[model samples]
Target chain A: MITLAVDCMGGDHGPDVTLAACRQFLNHHPEARLLLVGRPERLQGFAHERAEVVPASEVVGMDEPVEAALRRKKDSSMRVAILQVKEGRAQAAVSAGNTGALMAIARYLLKTLDGIDRPAIATQIPNMRGGATTVLDLGANVDCTAEHLLQFAIMGSALVSVLNDDPQPRVGLLNVGEEAIKGSEEIKRAGELLRAAAARGDICFHGNVEGNDIFKGAADIVVCDGFVGNVALKTIEGLASMIGGFLKEEFSRNLLTRAAAVVSYPVLAALKRRMDHRRYNGAALLGLRGLVFKSHGSADALAFEQALNRAYDAARNNLLERVRTRVAHAAVLPAAPDMASVPGATPPSPH
Target chain B: MITLAVDCMGGDHGPDVTLAACRQFLNHHPEARLLLVGRPERLQGFAHERAEVVPASEVVGMDEPVEAALRRKKDSSMRVAILQVKEGRAQAAVSAGNTGALMAIARYLLKTLDGIDRPAIATQIPNMRGGATTVLDLGANVDCTAEHLLQFAIMGSALVSVLNDDPQPRVGLLNVGEEAIKGSEEIKRAGELLRAAAARGDICFHGNVEGNDIFKGAADIVVCDGFVGNVALKTIEGLASMIGGFLKEEFSRNLLTRAAAVVSYPVLAALKRRMDHRRYNGAALLGLRGLVFKSHGSADALAFEQALNRAYDAARNNLLERVRTRVAHAAVLPAAPDMASVPGATPPSPH
Candidate 1:
């Protein structure tokens, strides 16, 4: 049976959402067991045949500084859940806590895989093709070198391969323009690195793609630094929500339009289901030594369940082994000199 | 009466769209005159009392490099249109040609205003509040320093003030996060410069805003580096189109949905009208000594006419004079140390 560690005292709703999600998740996956990490009193009376509470005294507030959470809260639920992954007590860990604190503790406790400079957050976004496009470095490392991007591409490719069952998933480097000469120097250098890696049969690089290409499903996987990815992701969310609001207002404009809304209810409902971001929750923190998935901090019970199911699937599919093997193969290739000389070139120390 | 220079042989449809737009634009504004610049052979037989064909020998291809179009094609229609603005033959110049080529020529000929290091591209985007937000540095100056962003904020605020009739428009610096400690070193430093400018009463700074805030109408003016701004703008365009395609597919699904589509046609049309990007055409190239506006390369006759109307309005309202006055006032503030040391800190060499 695959086991998953849950940060029960995390996210906006905390135990209210996480615990309810756990109940639903358990009903769906009979073979999966949960190691619920949180304060004993908060998680009390959670009686499931496959579930056990791992009590922790502290909880990391969503707005707390990463340093304070990391240094001061040693026994915090978020950290303890991640520790379960480090100790092999669980195959994967899931959290909807403070992203900064979660990433810091995961990096410090689980550490990064060999040949990976920094772990990147990868999440799925809805695309025009009806399927989803996986985008990486959501908000983990802000200032990334070309080498870090290359690593993200490799890791992202591996994740997509396992999830989509595509042997050679297409990888596109996100830039301002599709042309090679369009973006900043770092992006140009990363393009060269990605091309070289593609030559080694590491990935199928689909050249450069613009921001819109992400939603157009131009490539199976889109790679970018955290800053750009974060901004792009949030922009998509905002635009989608705004469009939704406009649609509602338009439908309710008058009696005729309101009646029209009723006649077209199924079409609108289907559209809503297709565009619902909650279905695509759970961003994987790839390149880590252990498996970790982060759900949105404000995720509802249904969304939290999706995150839990994603973690269970990753653990069952041996995603950690797959990432390790691909990264090992990629590391054997000759490193580009320009990528090696980037200022923050220190290798990540493995825990 | 205001005379506007038009690049007739620009954009994908060339004279087909521009000439038709000119005919319609002239009908709407009786006091306005157009100096249509293009090859004589292509401009033949188009006669209007308010429109005069100014012969040009060459045309810049949509995909031509900036250097080739600037130096090699000196007599290009795009160049001749801007030449009219520089020579005081027209109050403003409008082009639907190659953006890179147009910006390079405009900068080379008209140059920048006093104390402005780089000219930025500013365009209006529909917001949730039924109004539009002005975003600057759409794709002109990619690698921007803190000082360049400060100039963009001042210029964007000035544009919004004239266009939206808000004397003190709120300006927001776009970043990955709203927190002061978030984003790259350059963005953090830019925040300081923006805050200092706000203190000096140069602008009504709204502090840092995320990408979603652009659509949420959090501020009247959003300032960002060209790279990020371009990416965000294109991403929004791509998403809007994708959403459009999705809605069409949903409404046309089978016979029942198709029947419902007919009933809901009015609501859909209203939504489409509100979300129509064509209504928001014409990106102003700000900080130039002479006024210049860019139409999308693929704009149709109606869209191109909207750009012409925008140019006419700017000229009629004396946007250039307003921008000049605001920038001059901002230059008197004590410049931040970090902004002062940015590379390429030389004062603009005005025409």
Candidate 2:
């Protein structure tokens, strides 16, 4: 059975959202089991043959600082959930809690894989090809070197390979332009490194791609530093919400327009389902020795269940072993040159 | 009367688009005159009392390398057009040519303003508030210092004040999150500098804004390094196109969907017109001694006309003088220590 640890007392809704998602998840995956870790009293109502309640004393706040959550809240639900993965009791762990604290605790307990300096956050954004494109370093390292970028490309390749069953995924280095001479020095150098790795058969690099290329589906995997990736992700969310609002206003302009909206309801619903980001909720914290997936903090039952599904799939597919194999083959990720000195390069909390 | 120099032989469509735009622009604004710079033969067919064709010996290819275009194309139309601004023959210059070449020639001829280290590209993106958010460093300085960001905010404030008539336009530093300690060291330092400037009554700082804030209209002016800014701009373009394509597909899915589309045509058309990026085509090259505007290379007649209109408005309102006044009042722009030493920090080409 593919068993996963759940941080039940996490995210904005805490036990309310988590418990509902766990019950639904249990009904769908017959071969999957869960170790629900949270305050015993909070999870007592959630009883299933495939699920068991594990006790924890504290809960990490949505706005808690990473240092405080890691150093002070040693027995927090977030930490105990990851401990299940470290102890080999569960194949993977899932959380909807604070991202920075989760990454710090996961790194501290499980440690990073060999040849990987820092773990990166990877998520998929829906693209025009009726498929989703995986983007990495979503909000991890703020300032990354070329080597760090190269490592992200390799790790991302493994994630996509296991998730999509595509052995060789095309990796694109995110840049201002596609030209060889474009972007910051680190990006250009990363392009060169990616090309070299591609030559060695460690990856399938598609050269440089612009932000629009992410939605254009020009590459299967697009890698960027955390700051740019976060901005791009947020920009997409902002634009999508604005468009949704505009569509709603247009549909209810008057009695005549309201009739037209009723007629077009089927088409609109199909379009909405195709572009729904909730279907793509899970984000992998790759490069760590153990597999961990993060759900959006404000996710509802459906979205939280999607995260659980992704973690279950990653574990069953042996995603950790795939990443290790890719890293061992690349042999290019040199320990980031004193990661401590890179100002603001520490693991950052996600908004 | 305002006279603006035009690079008539620029962009992908060259004279076909630029000449048509100039005609419509002249008819709309009798107070505006154009000094069309290109091969005289290409512009000879057009005749207007307010427009005159100036001869040029060369043209800059859209995909030409920056160095080749800057060094080899001396008498290029792009150069002759800027020469009009430098020689005091026109109040401003407009081009839909290679961005890197345009920036190189504009900076080389006009020079940066006092206390300004580099010139930035500022453009407007339509927001939900029935207004547009002005974003800067679109594709000028790829690698920016904290001081460069501060200067961008000051210059962007000037652009908005003259164009939007908002004397104290709120400036937001683009980052991963809204919190003060959320981004890179340079971004953190830029936030401090902006806050200090706000304390001095030089600018109205809005703390930190994420990428979505540009579409949300959270701030009047959003400042970011060129790399991130360029990506945000392209990301919007890509996603908008994808949505447009999807709408077209859905409306033609079947006879029933087609009938619904016909009934809903008016509402859809209004939404399309509102979100049309062409209405916001003109991007001002800020921080230069002279006013220069850039149009999208692929812009058709209507979009090109909007760019010309923006340039006329900027020139009539004395955009250059406004920027100069703001910089003088701030007294915070320190000369960059060594721009040459920063790798890939040179002026970059826009896609």
Candidate 3:
């Protein structure tokens, strides 16, 4: 039986919404068990047949610093959820909590693979083709060296291999243009690394892709620095919201537009479904020692249930295990940072 | 009488499309005169009654380097068009041909206005409310400093004031978020500079705005590095294309949807007109000592005509003179760049 650990004290809805989702997921997967980590009293009212409570006394607010949260709130449910995966008690962990906290805890507790510097968070986003494209480092390591980007490419490509049975997942470096000469120093260097890696037959790197290329499905996986990745991800969400509001505003403008709106309701519904923000839930924190997923902070119970199902798949697939084996064998591990350098270290470049 | 310089060899469609647009524009405004600059023989057959042929011996292909094109193709129509603006023979110059060549020749011939380091291109894009917002530095500059961004804000604000009739144009620095601190080093620095500039009551700098904020008309002018600005512009255009394609695809899915599409045709038509790309044809290259405009390379005759009309407006408004006075009174001129450090200099940053 698979045991999925969850952080009940994370996200906007926190314990209540997360608890409801846990119950619903348990109902669906009768053989699955949950290790719900949070304050025992706060979770006392929730009763589920296949779930057990893990006593964690503290909570990390959405605004708390990731490292500070992990340090000061040692007993926080967020850290406990990830700790379950590290200690061999659970196969996978999921949280709709603070993303930075999940990543810090995952990397610190579970540890990175032999050749990985900083792990990345990879998510599948809806595309125009009704299919989805994978994007990595949505908020993992904001300052990445070219070499770190190379590792991200390898790890992200591995996730794509697991997601789609497509042979040799096509990879692309996210850039302002398709040219090799475009983008900043970091991106230009990363492009050369990816090109060299693609030639080596590790992954099919598909050259540079622009912001517009994401929706066009130019490649299977798009890799970027967490800063650019975060901006692109949020931009997509914000655009969907803007489009939704416009459609609603237009559809309600007097009798003529109203009549058109009624006739087009079914078509609009289908399009909206294809564009729904709730459909894609779990983003895996790749390159760590064990499985960890980050869900949306604003998610409700339904979205949380979707995350639970994702946790099950992530556990079954053994994503982190595959990443470790592939990266460890294909690339040489650079010397680890000294203890002093670790604290002030930004992500090293793949260059 | 308004004398507008037309680059007959400037656009993708070349002489044929330009000739048709000039003829149509002349029908609307009898006082308008076009000094159509290109190969005289090539344009002989298509010349309009109100247009006179100006001889030019060369053409700059879209792929040519900016500097080489200016030097080698000095006799080209694109160069001649700018010369018209510089020599005061024509009030304004318009081109739909090569962007780099146009900018190269314009800058080299007309030079920079007092206190401006780099000029920027501003496009009037359709917003959610059926109106438009002016976005700047579309592709004119790639790398930018904080001070350069401040200049863009001022120039974009001035354009909106003259063209958009917004007396106090609210400027927003395009960032990942609205928080002053939530952006890259350049944006963060630009924020402080903008705030200081705004405090003086010269221009209203609203603060940091995100990509989502563009279509929502969150600010009258959206400013950023040329690289980000270019990507954002293309991304928005790409989304419009995807949404349009999706709408059409869904409308043809089944008999029910087809019938609904028919019923909704009029409404869709109205919306399409309001969002029509042709209506917003010309993008002004701001911060120049002379008036210059770039039309869409793929623009049709109607769109091309609008480009000419836009040039007419800029010349009539005395854009260069106004910009000089504005900077002289309220804006600070940045120090000239130290030529030693310049390598593959993208756009100069507004610092």
Model 3 CA lDDT for position B348: 21
* Model 2 reproduced share of reference interface contacts: 0.74
Query: Cα miss at B30, model 1 (Å)?
Result: 1.9
lDDT of 3 by residue, B183-243 (tens): 5566677898889888887689988877667778888898876766766666566666777
DockQ of 2: 0.76
- What would the per-residue lDDT of candidate 3 be over residues A156-245, giving only the tens digit for each residue? 887877777665888888776676776666678788888887777777989988777777888989888665676567656655666667
lDDT of each: 0.87, 0.91, 0.78
DockQ of 3: 0.32
The lowest-lDDT stretch of 10 consecutive residues in candidate 3 chain A is A342-351
Q: What is the lDDT of residue A260 in candidate 1?
A: 97
The candidate with the higher TM-score, 1 or 3, is: 1
Indicate the worst ten consecutive residues by lDDT in candidate 1 chain A: A342-351
Candidate closer to the true structure by DockQ (higher is better), 1 or 3? 1
Which structure is stronger by TM-score: 1 or 2?
A: 2
Better of 1 and 2 by DockQ: 2
In what order do the candidates fall by DockQ, top score first? 2, 1, 3
Per-residue accuracy of model 1 over A72-188 as CA lDDT, tens digit each:
999999999999999999999999998888888998999878888788899999999989999988877667778888989999998998889898899999876677776667788
> Relative to the unseen true structure, what is the C-alpha lDDT of residue B249 in candidate 1, on a scale of 0 to 100?
93
The reply for model 1, stretches above 4 Å from the true place, is: A332-351, B332-351
For candidate 2, write residues B50-131 as lDDT tens digits.
Answer: 9999899899999888778889989999999999999999999999998988998898889989989889999999999989
